[model samples]
Target: MTESTPALPQRPWRQRYHVAAIGWTLLLAVLLVLSSLMTGANFGTFLSNIDQFLALLVQMSHPAWSYLHVILQPLYETIQMAVLGTTIGAVLAVPFALLAASNLVGNRLLRGLIRFFLDLVRTLPDLLLAAIFVAIFGIGSTAGVITLAIFSFGMVSKLFYEVIETIDMGPLEALKSVGATKVTIIWYAVLPQILNQFVSYFLYTLEINVRASTVLGYLGAGGIGVYLQRSLGEFNYSATAVIILATLVVVLVIDGISNHLRRVLL
Candidate 1:
């Protein structure tokens, strides 16, 4: 009909960026394939062997309800361990978190040292910690409790210090201007502002500790994991199913409580 409208030319920078993104994506895909090959991970093999997994699932479909009575004591022990460990760790983390907070601690060197210590603590995986504690404290719930406490301390301290760093400085400054002591300023200015966040994080840590305590039991730390290990070893899928269902119920209950508390605090 009329003269055709000319297409707008793409920007050189835009075209280069697009090409770079595509290149990176292709490289990533190639790396993934290479890594899978190196690890002997074959999707085709998994697809072919999937029926074995289905059979296992069928075995677990019917839970042994009577197993609940036997596990009640161990489950109670697990909950108690989580509560005690969380309390101990959370209480201990306050001073360490304050020391680690860059905003609170004016000395960069001191903050760095505290953070380094925290990093060192965090480097030890939970399973490794449990094993170490089990060796030191002997095989019992005591080792599990100690492991949970250390794990919670490392995690909660990091979370708390980050929260401290993000707090509004205005109240802190105001408190300082009134010649308030460090502890007083923290109690009045900082803690109030971050109290809700602290509770939320503490609850989150408690929930995690519950799951972790179960695993610690495998190393003779004492919990439901011992039973889980035994069930798998004995090929008792029915008992394993009951244990899994009970743990799921406990997790769901904790989650519900955590959600409710978070909503109230928020």
Candidate 2:
């Protein structure tokens, strides 16, 4: 009897992946070197600046607690700005998101156009939007509110559409089979599925807007960021430290609230 030829073992697909990964790694290393040379990103400069950075840290170690009282009004204004902006943006995003969702609209051209416009709107940075609004509205919370509204609109619209797309189609189909009107179908079927996600995203956006409004104030858009900018410009590290700590506390509180609400909703 002829000896049976040993069956050759098949190489795992992961072996091929390893070979391709090595090639990509080398390519990325070469590109990184070229980029570093082109950009003059010297590690030595960063090392030298470490001392200066440490000195500033030392100066800010003791925050100016007295300034906290003074910043209360601006802090309140910042919260107000975030609330107003998020409310306006979320309301506006609802209709746009519904229209942009392919599952909801069923019009490929319209959905594509709306998504394209949303993408365009998102590409404009918040700071740039705030600057433009400041120019138009002539400084104050009004410009900040408008900027935050637009920014929140662009972000929430994308998120809301994604949620709409991921929702169970069974309920929607059932509603349609019942010969329900579009409004009734949305109210009874679509809204229930997406409402929780909508609230979750709205709160998340509110958290972001609170932080962003601070920076917007630097551009004369109105909030604590104005004070933050001024303190930094004047080299008042202690006051800046206070602002940073206060902002950090606010962010943590907002995050905690968001987490609680998400748990309840989920």
Candidate 3:
């Protein structure tokens, strides 16, 4: 007869861990219920309001095609603002990003300071920035451009430095051993490896700025947003729909270009 093997016993720790997980899950469920109650999130109210929401949606369903001709100029201006802002921000971010890269900058304090400044810039709301710029620059696309540039700088710098940190250190060390200056090493060793990634990030930032520029116009910074606000104020949902559709088309075109460029770069 063949010998039969005994079944292995379950460990006490495993049972305890399973029980702990159940307890934590129950606690989380209780917290979720309590929070929902505290926040007054009533599903019944939403259900009651659904008809009104659908009515508004029905109104927006028919876009005003004739309004498109009128908005073409403002739409072009919005694209221009996004392009100018993204370009300025991306160019200015390069040196700061290099400084913020922990591998590139040996001094921890300097990197910390640079990172802190980036954080400060990122904390400023874009709408508030637009408002401030409008006050200073006096209601034009220039204010929109400046606002977008600052916003893009904060975002792109963080992304660039993170990309820099992930780069292979082998090239850097190789350059350093050959008696190269810091700038020379960066130019030859660092730029080549991360160039594709940088371009991809820049394009991504540009895409975002295009969307942001629309809202900036609400602050009198100049874009189709001014028309959007006017249409909404005048209760002209058809024109508002046309503006939204136009903005969507611009976003889609930018996205397509960005995808094509990324494929080519890769």
Top of the candidates by TM-score? 2
Error of 1 at 155 (Å): 1.5
**Residues 221-258, model 3: lDDT tens digits:** 99988898889889889888999999999999999999
Give candidate 3's error at residue 65 in angstroms.
Answer: 1.0
Separate clash counts for every candidate: 0, 0, 0
Candidate topping lDDT = 3
| lDDT (0 to 1) per candidate | 0.90, 0.92, 0.93
lDDT of 1 by residue, 52-78 (tens): 988888989989898899888888888
> Where is model 1 poorest over a 10-residue stretch in terms of lDDT?
8-17
Alpha carbon deviation, residue 7, candidate 2 (Å): 6.1
Show model 2 residue runs off by greater than 4 Å: 1-19
Residue-by-residue lDDT tens digits, candidate 2, 169-189: 899899899899999988999
**TM-score between candidate 1 and the true structure:** 0.88
- Model 1 misplaced regions, further than 4 Å: 1-10, 13-17
Model 3 poorest ten-residue lDDT run: 7-16
Q: Which sections of candidate 3 miss by over 4 Å?
A: 1-39
